[model samples]
Target: MSTDVLIVGAGPTGLALGIDLARRGVDALVVERAGELFPGSRGKGIQPRTMEVFDDLGVLDAIHAAGGGYPVGMIWQDGQRVGEHRMFDPVEPTEDSPYDAPWMVPQWRTQRILFDRLEELDGKVAFGLEAVGLEQDEDGVTVRLATGGSVRARYVVAADGGRSAVRRSLGIGMTGETVDPNPTLVADARITGLDRDNWHIFPPRGEGDGFLAVCPLAGTEDFQVTAQFPEGSSVDLSLEGVRKVVAARSHLAPEDVTEVRWASDFRPRAALADRFRDGRVFLAGDAAHIHSPAGGQGLNTSVQDAYNLGWKLGAVLRDGVDEALLETYEEERRPIAADMLGLSTSVHRGEVRRGEATRQLGLGYRESSLTAETRQAPATLRAGDRAPDGTLGGVRLFDAFRGPHWTLLAVGAEAPELPGSVRVIRGPAQESYGKGLFLVRPDGYVGWAGDTADGLPRYLARAGL
Candidate 1:
């Protein structure tokens, strides 16, 4: 009946947060209204930045084993392969940024991986237990569940979907507009007569109809079928309905769609919560922001949201740091969420391509209150930038940053005595990160940078080192 942190929802956001907290030994509980994990392949694209996060979280190997690189898009007209279209700009992997491409894994599989990781860390999730009402005080939160039980926690997170019951219980309002008026049906189906090498696209034959794209889901024997409908049109999610749509749009017959594994329909929209926090409760993922699934930013942003909040919560609860550190969650992530919302909308409207911006490697908290740049002239890797990965002192930087701790990269600089909690890696100057003392945060961002350790101790003190 009691926990340190209670999370609502078992989606990628909640599962990811649970994994981070469990690894940090935080007493957290994840509750899902549904009996099982999400059954669809929605939000299947994992951005490179999220891949890095997964690497640190100890699930990258499994993710790599279960997913594959996105195939090129194949255009089709009158049942003939016409041309090839690249969904994203090509980028080569480098020492600084290893994962340069988006990896495809069904969202359901991603959640399962996170769930298994959570269990390995002794974390727990109660399915079919929905938080119907919530009340918070100076000490903790008391949540009323639909299953006739109450859970008390020091803090609560709403990782539920856009129609978050927890957010509603707190009376939070979301403001935004619909990204598209037309309804879209996205489904995972087993089909024949299609090679699993490229994403097949069939343009609408007439004005009253809409576009259809059937993409081979990597690492699976299934294809994700996405079809658009006219404005004010209702989407049909039945197997027969899907067959009709496919047969009418493309050359595939109705029986080609042998099985409809899972299906859902929605109109693309973007909305951001009025606020992410209220007293001891917070909103994250779709509970915080909603995005059109164009540039594959929604799930990645949501997972990063959990990553951002996990360390702060661990610090406050496990390490006895100031609660004010929790304030940075909203301060830093809200702006990023807003920017990603705009980017997803733009990508949906065909204004931008899935390029470098969509990778999310360049996003950082340069203006955050926690960032401290003491150098007179900052280089490409500033204090508020992501800590680039490279070999330092015969060790990979990511290996040093794997656990729940800060890392001090004393590249080409004299090392100083630091707290045991902060891991220090000394090495020669690397091209990506110029010679300097770079203090990496627990979430892999450069928190402080200076020519020496003159201000390092001061910064550490603020973080309760």
Candidate 2:
């Protein structure tokens, strides 16, 4: 079989990419090694920036319906509630930024939502097909599957997890340190004797004990149980083992944990690939970077990776843009990934709080080669910054930015004559954007900004607009 793009792994990253590409009319196939989608509450926090990406992908409504806001944390001592702790700093939604806090959706449920959207867009995913080996040339990539079948494509994306087989096949090296040497056990289970309103936290009572946290999984009856073990200790993921851990840590009895749905174990660590691209194959999500789950940056960063690449791939494959446009994928995302890695590590080590930075709305590509800031001094918004959401001339900025197209925003500035392909929104009251003409990329960043429309056309032609 063959296609324009071959995406490996059906996790949130691959599925989100599939949805974006499908809506853009890009012919792409998502292949997963497992027979079905992942079934865990791992990587459950959906950051605000990702919420915006979901909105553009047409899955925001469903995602909001399938998840709920994270609850406050309730600390327990001697089986009695002591104090309340907020997982994240509270921020109200503003007109410029809609989603203020993280939403809670199990990784499995998020992937399912993305998969359904992909299917709705006529996208395809072939299960039980694992990429074992791959050979790519100047034209395309041919992947050898473990099932003895081969698939070819113009490009391949490895959205596989941290121990990505495709990443290993490419011989790419990961550089980082273990945030914590202690092992951690994470599980989803149905339990009684606990209210679903607060996340229960159990601090170590004595020496050799570990911290335990049981958070109610939003939009579901199951609760995710996480426990830290001593260094050099192996974690137990069995149902009985989970029950024992719960009973030992919290006041609940072993019988309270009635059913264990899914469980796994891991050690907290962070790593990033030396490069994101290798010939025709590219690494994305955990394939390119690994993060400690502290600030919930791994999955959010991964999905955004797909969002960043989807439009570029669409531009080159379907919009006749220069293939050199593809080079920006690494040039732009690698640094962002590296920054997120540091943030996640800081959060893991208690050096940073999960606040504004964790929301990811402030991230941008001002230094990217694709960005052109021609204005003498930009105001609230600038080139390489994320275009804020607000109503301008009765048209919502997000509404205008939606879909696989570039947008020109003439804010308190005279509009220019441009190709009909670029959607234009003109308004004089958009406070988020001062008096300037902004060219918004398909990925929602302002690629070029100027005091007027003087260099706009040239910037467009340079960006293959």
Candidate 3:
């Protein structure tokens, strides 16, 4: 099958890119190495910024309806109830606000929502398809499908999982370090001594090797456990090994545990692909970067990477923008992914010392020429900042509300009319007014966000909005 964009891998990243492009009416084909969706949980939390992306995909409701709500709060190490404070809560993205809280949802559930949205858009990701080889030239890229045939694409996006074929084909090296092997045992288990109400974090109890974390699993009482792995071990995440880690960190005995669902050996690392784009081919999600799953960033970061790349690709396909516009994908997303890696690493490191945040508010994007005029400090526009959502009536309209068209949540006092091209919502302005009326794109990232002076059309023109 020929497509304007050929995406490999249907994990959150590939699905996100596919949905983003399809929402914008771009023809995209997403191929995954796996035979089907990731059935079990992987990344189990969602940040505020990513919530906005889900909104854009028009699947937040389904996600929330499925397994999306913040029905519970975050928990701490000492068995004390962890408040929402710890979850990087940046005030609403309003020009007058400072932060918001990260949402909690299992990665498998999130992937299901994304896949459903893709289907709604009439896009289907071919599962069990591998990319053995591909050919690209000056104008377009040709992709080989493991399903027996091939696809010719105007562009290719390597949403492929770790060890990406497209990235290797382009010879991109990953630049980052493997974190200090905080060897941990992770598994699905049921325990009588522990409570599943909140995410439980147990730092090497009085005399243990590492930390033990108990995260809630959807549809059941079993919680996911993570603790130090034994000295000499195999990848086998059996109940006994899971019990060993739980006993090592927490005071819980594994045998008292029942209903072992799933288990695995996990090590956190930070990796950023040296380049996000090579010629007409690009990388998104794990194909572009890999990092510790500590902060539940794997799915969110990968999803957002494609969210940022989607509109640009759609524009290129529509013959409305120059190819150079696509460069912004890496120029923008790479730093954010790098930030996720660093922050997750920090949170993981803090597990040893019982501490962390570099800030949910501490993250944002002030670097791109897009925000240059706003003169907003990097702190307000840092690459990793939390996006905002609004309290409307009895309901809440998040900053990430996606439209079939572009939207301008006019954070300024007086909202202007810009025809039907952009949806303008005026109310209390952003606390960081200098960041201006945020011009949120359909994919949820700031396309041309700045102060009111920047105006609408000009912001659109600056970004080819």
Candidate 4:
């Protein structure tokens, strides 16, 4: 009937936020319309950055035990491996970095992991519960559930999918056009012919006539297969359709790719909401932005959204900061979401161009305000940047130190002990800010990184950290 925070949708973002808040001793609830957990692994394969976040959450080990990691992902043309490089392997630790190659797991599996963590903190997700109506006042949010019950919360976070009931309840509008009419055939099933170890990305090869990506699911023998739909033709999305996709793409027939587990037709779009928050209500994950799944960044972006907002919400409730601080959710994340939508759109466009640009320029958040404070000049990566991990120094800080605390990444021994809200860690001395001061948020993100600790206590005072 009441909670400190109420979250809609039990997917990755909601689950992660709920667990984070619960761990910090907040009363949180997650509501979902489906009676059962999400059935399949629609958005699996955690990215390197997100794995770092998981490490900070203190659950990386559980995820690692249950997840898998591959060394390389390559581009293929009709089963012939072409463009090749290592994106996941020899995961070396670089300056101020943490974690290794990303731990690959299914979307549902991730939710289960987060839910398990939440349960440990007196939290559980309610499936088949829907927020049909939402009303807000100065004190709290009033949510009308479909089951004829109601809930009151200091704040509500909408992690619902693209068709969000919470967003509609407010007057916020989702602005942007569909990137294209392109629909892709996606499956969470098994295939016989392809090698399971490597990420096999097929480009317009043979009868497939488009791209196909076959990746091994973490901790399971099952392999995830994805193939782009032909320019005009669409699958029926029935069990037979799932078989047909594999049959048409791979060297084998329908019988070759059996088990026929689960399948769907995903119409990937590039769209973002005009706003992410309204009074006591906020939008996150697919509720805030929608984009193509080309680079597997959709879920990562969503989870990061939760990581960014969870601490703010918890901090506000815990120690009493300005509710207005929540407005930064849009100011900070909207651009990131917008950038992802545009980047994914460009990647899909490059699929037709056969251009090398999209394949090379992975999305880098170097321009973020978190990194901007440490910006002298941008290297391949920078302070506010999504810190890239490569073998550097004798230690691995990023992956190893990921946890639910602010990290102060000192390039050298000059790492100062600024206690209140800033976290500090040490990395190799390779560039500027080696002895400088920087702060990493609890979610493995950079917030205030600078050469001096000046105005830092003030920054934390304002964030209520």
Candidate 5:
């Protein structure tokens, strides 16, 4: 089969990229090695910045319906509820930042929502098709599948997990360190003795013991069970083993865990690929970087990777933009991934608290080559910063930034006539933006900011606007 883009793995990254490309009318296909979607509550925390991305992708309403707020953590000792611990620093929602906190939705459910959205956009995913080998020239990429088939595409994206076959096939190396040597077991099960009010935590009773946490998976009846084991200890994923662990660690009886739906084991680690791009194929998500699940950064960062690349791929494949635009993907995302990896490691080692840093709203590409800050004096909201959401001239900023198009926000300044493709919103001087002309990129960052439209035309031509 021939296509514009071929994506490997049907996780959040691939599915999100598929949806974005489909909306932009780019012909893309996602291929997954597994026959079905993942069925675990592995990556459960969706950061606020990712929530904004979901809003632009048209899945925010469904996500809100399918998830709930993170509950307070309840400390348990000797079968008594001791004290309450807040998992994250409390932040109130504001007009500038709508999604101020993380939302709790299982990774499986999030992927399902993204898949459904992709299907709605007329995108397709081929299951059980593993990318065994690939070759790329100056024009396109040719991928050989294990199922006795091949695909040719203008570009290929590796959204596969940490042990990515595509990354390995490209001979790329990853630099990483073991965040924790102890093994951890995470499972989803139906329990009878636990209430869904708060996350229950059980501290280790002895030196060699491990910590255990049982969190009720919001929007579902199952509770996710996580347990830590000593270094060099093997983890048991069987139902009986889970029952034994639960009974021994907490006040609940062995019979409390009635059914085990899905379970897995892993050791915490942080790794980053040396490069994100190799010829016509690019690595994204866990394919490019691996993170400890402590701050829930892995999946959030992975989804953003797809979001960052989707519009660039659309511009190149559909809008005939310069191929050099693709080079900015790694230039922008790699540093963010590296920083998030550090945040995750810090959260895992108790060196940092899950506060504003974990929200991810502050991440931006100020230092990227694509950003143009032409203003003599930039404000807090400047080029390369995320455009805040608020009302301007009775039009909601997010509503103006929704579609796959750039936005020109003339805040307390005269508007300029632009191409029909660019959406324009003008309003009196707002506190957030001050007085300036902000050119918002398709991915919701300020591409250029100036006091007037003096350099707007040149910038527009450069961005293919």
Candidate 6:
């Protein structure tokens, strides 16, 4: 089959990119090796920045409905509640930043939501099909599948997980370090005698023991169990093994641990690909960067990767923009991925707190080549910054930016004559945005800022507006 984009893996990254491409009327297909969607609660914390992306993708309401805010951490000693611990530093919602904290949703539920949204948009996902190898020419890429069938596409994205076959076939190298020598066993289980309010934490009782935490998965009856093991220890994922660990660590008995729905073990490690792209194939999500699950940056970063590349791919294929626009994807995302890797490692090592940095609201691309700042002196809001949400001329800024179109906010500055494709919002100066002509990209970052419309036309032309 022939298509415009061929995405490998049906995880969040691939499904999200498929949804974005489908909404833009791009012919894209997602191929997954697994027979069904991933069934796990591995990456459960959704940061605030990702929440905004979900809003634009038309899945924010479903995401909010499927999950709830994180519960406080309850420390335990001798089967009694000792003290309360906060998982994240408390932050209140503001006008510009509405989602101030992380939301808890099982990874399985999140992927299910994204898949449903993709199908709602008529996006196609072919499961049980794997890309064993691929060859790209100047015209397009031809992927060889394990079923002996092939898919031809103009561009390809490898959203496959950490051991990405596509990335390996391209000979891309990843450099990283093991964040922790201890192995961690994570599982979803049905337990008794544990209230579904706070996350119960059990400290190591004696030497050679490890910590155990049981957190109630939001919007579900299952509780996620996590236990640490000493270095070089083998983890048992069977029901009896889980029961033994739970009984030994917490106040629960073997009978209280009723079932083990899903379980896995892994040693925390941080790694980044040598390059995100090689020829026509690009790596994304765990295929591009691997993160420790401490600060909840892994899944959030992966979804944002798809969000960043989606519009650019649409622009290059559908719009008459230059293909050079695609080059900025790695240039913009790689550094951000590297920074998030460091943050995740820090949070894993207990060197950093999960506060403003973990929220991912402050991430921006001020140094990117795509950003153009024409103003001699800019205020707090400048080019390469995220476009804050507020009301302008009785119109909600987010409502104006909810679609797959560029937004031009003329706040106390006259908007220049532009193409009909760009959505323009005009009003007096607002408290958050200040007074400026801000050109917002499809991904919600300000590409250019100016005091007037003097240089907006040029910036828009360069941005293919």
TM-score winner between 4 and 5, please give it.
5
lDDT of 2 by residue, 318-353 (tens): 989898989999999999999999999999999999
lDDT of 2: 0.94
Instruction: Give per-residue CA lDDT, model 4, range 202-254, as digits (tens).
Output: 56656637666777786877777777775677666665776776666655578
Residue-by-residue lDDT tens digits, candidate 3, 1-465? 788888988888888888878877888898887888886666776665566567667887776665532334454545454453333333344532312455556667778888988999999788788887788888798887767788898999898877898888778899888775656566767787765565666655454355566767755566776666444445457777666666655555667667677776766678889888888888888888887876666776787788778878887776476677787778877788787787777776664221223223334555764453352543354322334555422224454245556666555434556756677666554443223455665554455555454455666665555
Total colliding residue pairs, candidate 2: 0
Please list the residue runs of candidate 1 whose C-alpha ends up more than 4 Å from where it truly belongs after superposition. Answer: none
TM agreement with the true structure for every prediction: 0.99, 0.99, 0.80, 0.82, 0.99, 0.99
lDDT of 6 by residue, 1-465 (tens): 999999999999999999999999999999999999999999999999999999999999999999999999999999899999997778999989988899999999999999999999999999999999999899999999999999999999999999999999899999999999999999999999999999999999999999999999999999999999999999999999999999999999999999999999999999999999988889999999999999999999999999999999999899978988889999999999999999999999999989999999989989999999988789988899899988999999999998889999999988878899999999999998889889899999999888888877777777788
The lDDT for every candidate, in the order shown, is 0.95, 0.94, 0.67, 0.71, 0.95, 0.94
TM-score for candidate 3, please give it. 0.80
Task: Give the candidates in order of lDDT, highest first.
Answer: 1, 5, 6, 2, 4, 3
Off by over 4 Å in 3: 68-99, 190-193, 201-208, 230-232, 243-255, 351-362, 372-401, 408-420, 424-440, 444-462
lDDT of 5: 0.95
Which residue runs of candidate 6 sit more than 4 Å off their true CA positions?
Answer: none
lDDT of 1: 0.95
Cα-based lDDT at residue 378, candidate 1: 79
Angstrom error of the Cα, residue 113, model 1: value is 0.5
Q: What CA RMSD would candidate 5 show?
A: 0.7
Local accuracy of candidate 5 as per-residue lDDT tens digits, 133-184 = 8988999999999988899999999999999999999999999999999999
